[model samples]
Target chain A: MIDSIARPTAAIRARPVLGAASVVALFVALWMALIWSPPDAAMGNVVRILYVHVANAWLAYLAFVVVFLASIAYLWTKRPAFDAIAVASAEIGVLFTGLTLVLGSIWAKPTWGVWWSWEPRVVTTAVMFAMYVGYLLLRNLSNDLERRATRAAVLGIVLVVDVPIVHLSVTWMNALHQLPTVLRPDLSPTLDPRMLASLVAMTIAFTIVYAYLMTARVDIERRRQARIIEARA
Target chain B: MTIARIWRIAAREALAERGHPDGFVAAITFVATLILVESLAVGPLAAGQPPVAAALFWIAMAFAAILATTRSFDRELEDDAIDAILALPGGRDALYGGKVVALTALLALVALVGGLLSGVLLSLAIALPGHLALVLVAGVLGLPPVIVLFVTLALRLRARGALVPILALPVLVPQLVAATNGTAAAIVGDATGALGWTGLLIAFALVYSVLGLTIVPTALE
Candidate 1:
């Protein structure tokens, strides 16, 4: 099945520019993040990791938002393309969320004096991570493509509801983690200007990487579906 | 008419459960074993350890609910009973509503058994019995509809036995947290906070049941 639908060499050749651009963007972003951004008042160098970590976290949420919309579209239209996008988005979202958790732990070790804490943000993020991992596992459960897509779309829409609830519940619980500095009800910026610029650059770089990976993954899924349909015919 | 139909389906499920008793028996045994293992591990709860007791109770009830839901759905799937029911008018809604009712009753029983055991063997005091009942009622009420929806989603899956808990539990964290906190409040004699937590559980139950009703047909397909 995989061999039958493997991405053609030419298609890969056409996307070399995107691949190169992402690598270049990430490198520049990393250089700016480490060297250009000023060290923190207290956290110093460890705070630099925040640029990449927070960027990946933001991208994970963005990817899942795409998944939620694509899943809804798949249900409304029964389109294979929408399902492919949703699945691809979910896979990428999970990857970024996993990275967020690891980087979070690394940050926590130095800052919170522990490898892990049941701080609301950490707890909710862990649950969100597990939920999407379950979503991916669920997609593999069915052999019937239509059934698989329908069930996964239903779950995708339903599970997205938990994201806000996780946030709400965490807020209700006393959060040991520091409250949000930037993304808040008030959108006033708080960081040093250079640091903010570095963070913004990293965010754009991560988003571009996400877009690139999602497109490639969706193309692979489109080919797989085409091959399957053709083989049946 | 719809209400009557849902009630009839729930009654039939109850009757069938009375005869088979696997889900009920398994849930009871599971909760009992949990309480026993917990007692052995902790070697009797201290007087002021309401939070510990509440956490143990919630964990036991949650796993028991998982067992009961899987068995309850498996019975219907075994004889293609679910397929036959789906072919009938209003079966999707009725089946979901009925499963919610039936599972709620089974879980309430498990909660009672677990709570009683915890009070006795673990030496934990439920200082406010009324609040404790409300906490249990709110928690048990919230689980069934969500669990029913998950069971439906897993019905056609190959590894449903493993998949149901994975899909259901994470979504249930809010409900479980509210319930556990409420139970702890009741144990610790914090009536106001316990009531607030119960309110949260009620809200969760309402939201999930409405959502489950809307999604059951699509998921069953």
Candidate 2:
């Protein structure tokens, strides 16, 4: 049913090159950016947190985009393969979100004078982490493949709708959280060019890592399903 | 024959699944305990900032809301009527809607009762007529949209009871943030100033209501 629509070989082949060159190019860029970027006079060595923290946060949304896309494909095509992709994306999204939270905390302890803040961004990140964790746990608890995929697809799509709202909430709460400078219309060079280079590099590296993990996870699921069928037959 | 009658039957069947009294007692007891803890926790900081108490108050409410949501669907699953109810004449939307209303009403009733008592406990002593009343009503009313969302997610969630906190907590962030802002403004004596927060809460409530309406049926289907 799935192979008729998507040649598994294409997806499987598309990974090694897209994933590897992208990752290698990414890390080299990070080395050039981080070691070469000028450090701010205000927070000397500590600013390194920006590269990791920012990239992880970017990846969180990226992973969700994948989960969303895969879910849409599953619903439209009714493909088991796409359901596996959605699950894989969600799982990766959770890990990256955790990384974001941890990096935020590490950065905060040194800069914000406290480990945690009621700031809107921090709280929403924690919430996103928990929501996706729930998504994965729900998938694990269900036994039926059709039921699990259908349910996960529904939950996955519904939950992604909350992300932008969470981002907006930090500003809406009038709290300590700052708005993103990079994506907004107005940009005053927030960081020196090197740090920006590091972030850009890290972003690509993490994305490649995300793709590799998702493919591996989905392949694991596909094989497990195949074995189940083989055992039955 | 009518959609109205279908709604009524759906409501009645859902109601039959969950018999009330015990859940009411549990919610009340939990909130009473929360109110006590809030009063004590903020008492030391009370002199520095009254608004902190208001913020503390709503955090407690958020926790209590989660606790109460479990009982909403726990009964149906416990008595093994969930599948039968899903297969009802109108299908899962009707049942999900009925559950949402029942849970929202139950949460509101409990939150209202507790909010009344917490109002006396906080004793901000400021002219919070606008802020206090708005926060009081909105805080309780604000819960239904949230309860509907979490309960809807809980339907498919593994560890439904345990999963409530996980799924609901993230979605509840804005609600909590707004409640804190609105209540803090009220507690600090600018009840009118708190109106913005209340308006935002209303907006959130509307969003969640639509979200619940749109998504719950799909989850059920």
TM-score of each: 0.93, 0.84
Q: Which candidate ranks first by lDDT, i.e. highest? A: 1
Clashing pairs in 2: B131-B191
Across A9-28, the per-residue lDDT of candidate 2 in tens digits comes to 46566778767866687668
- lDDT by residue (A124-207, candidate 1, tens digit) is 888999999999999888767788888889889988885665545545667777655567668877889999899989998998
RMSD of 1: 2.8
TM-score of chain B of each: 0.95, 0.81
Q: Tell how far residue A57 is off in model 2, in angstroms.
A: 1.7
**Docking quality tier of candidate 1?**
medium
Q: Can you write out model 1's per-residue Cα lDDT over B1-221, one digit (the tens) per residue?
A: 65676788789888988999989999999988987887678766442278877877788888889899888888888878888878888888888888888899889888888788878876776789999999999999988988888888888678888998998989889888899899999988999999999999999999999988887777775
In model 2, state the lDDT of residue B49: 55
In order, what lDDT does every prediction score? 0.84, 0.71
Q: Report how large a share of the reference interface contacts model 1 reproduces.
A: 0.82
